[model samples]
Target: GYKGDQIRDFFLTYGDQGRDVTVNLASGGSPQWYGDPQTEDWEVTLVETGTGARIKRVAAYLDQPYFLQTYGDGIGNVDIGALYTQHVASGLVSTVTGVHPTSRFGEMHVSGERVTEFNEKPTMADGWVSGGFFAHKREMVDRYLDDDPDLLLEKKPMQTLASDGELGVFTHEGFWMGMDTFRDWTELNGLWDSGDAAWKVWA
Candidate 1:
């Protein structure tokens, strides 16, 4: 079974502070980028579940040019920016910002041609991009979930979506962390006890 509360918490943590965000859960493989190639846009971030570290800025975009698959090992093998570039070069996608990786977190960043400047570091100043939290629009769900049963909605889907510009990012300006192992869980609990969880929402 899925951790409904955890899902709820995750969505609430990323949802707009005062707006209503609907989270739909379906039994499947993963979620994919679904939106108009011309209008939708988004960004990607690497979140380490064990250490709760938002390693780097990954990618950004607004179409379904590529798809990444997650095997049994749990790690995703996404080319990050290759798909978008191919699409843009081939004219399948509009002329948008190119994709690049960051230094601190080793994540990728994608921007449109209109995106004049780029930030190297993640901070509360940049809507907490380094924190790995995001604020997505309702349309993200509507397009991504277009009655796809096999869609798992996992990390790969997110990566592909962000890379394709189907999702937008609303970085949070607080503590954030991901728990992927027993050690990480313990450490996160300790941080919570000491009042230092970056992703703490109910505190």
Candidate 2:
């Protein structure tokens, strides 16, 4: 999934060292590695899965009772410490970050042809979408994950969790963005330049 020392370097920048980071990536059949990086404390291992391996492959390397899995490109200002606490308290197999996606267009409430209320790029309050930040218990992964290589983490597994009343959600009303396109990259850069990034949780 992830290549090179970028992850290691990132954590080093934040003064976190000697961390074991496991990344699961399934391109076509499984993950393929590129090379090795020489680092002191940080170590990132790449695990290969099929296109549908989803997050199940991570169960193999999940050392802790609880592990956090976040998309490399997704950024948010979620209180992860609090999320961990909630997951433990709820005793669910999994807990994921729930975010209200911002509307691409402005919203207008009209009353008798009069613009009563207008909100520009407002956050949607109807349904929440998963922000790709996940916390999972070993048992959850062990019980749900299979080697089929066609399973989707967000599909049947998640649905089963919901059906079994085992899914927990930590709602975040703050900003959440994924750097998927050039426009997204530019927007994040703009926020960085303007010092107005809502996802900046660090000092």
Candidate 3:
């Protein structure tokens, strides 16, 4: 939703309050942590890189053996700890969170030209898709991912990983939705306003 530097600036202000904030404007940018370290429940870091940089370039800053990645547009009640545990148990280079996506069109059941039942935007009964909550070992970047700035994560890297049998999947049957449209934005806001947001797993 936020364009240009709006998202970065918002987080910078939010993190700068009652805490120190530092930003690096160089290549291979450093970790820009937000919020107070002692009291904050989670850590937020904004890593700056060149425009049109590849995902692997940004990932080069990752110092940990394992890390998570996801698109900002999707929200869900995915269990992060469980995902990490599954990744470890599977011993794969990466683990992708798969979800049954809701259909864009309404479903209708008919018998002899008589409308029997109808469901609006129902969740599909078959097939799971990547919901973007990815848990990856550092080896994935070292092996599968490339240094090309034009490389897309969903393209060659994922394809190669699956072909190599190193990509595991963690299926999450709970609430998940992607905010790619205005309708989705309104629906998510309505849920939050009505206090019925299923993705709000925290107190």
Q: Which ten residues in a row have the lowest lDDT in candidate 1?
A: 50-59
Write candidate 3's Cα lDDT for 1-203 as tens digits: 23637767866665456666577767657757766643455666666544333457767578889988878899899999999999988989999999999998999999999989999999886999999999999888878876676767888889999999989999999989999999999989999999989999887
Off by over 4 Å in 2: 2-43, 48-50
What value of lDDT does candidate 3 attain over all alpha carbons?
Answer: 0.83
What's each prediction's TM-score?
Answer: 0.31, 0.74, 0.82
Top of the candidates by lDDT: 3
| Candidates' C-alpha lDDT | 0.38, 0.78, 0.83
- Where does candidate 2 clash, by residue pair? 18-41, 31-48
Residue 59 displacement (Å), model 1: 27
lDDT of 2 at 94: 91
- Tens digit per residue, CA lDDT, model 2, 166-202: 9999998888987888977998999999999988886
How many collisions per candidate?
26, 2, 0
Candidate 1 residue-wise lDDT, 1-203, digit = tens: 23445645644444344444344466554444343223224443333223111111112332444433222211112232543344334432122122122234423355764655556434323222222222233344444443333444545446667678654332222333444567556766787699765444432
- Model 3 residue 99 lDDT score: 96
Better of 2 and 3 by TM-score: 3
Candidate 1 similarity to native, TM-score: 0.31
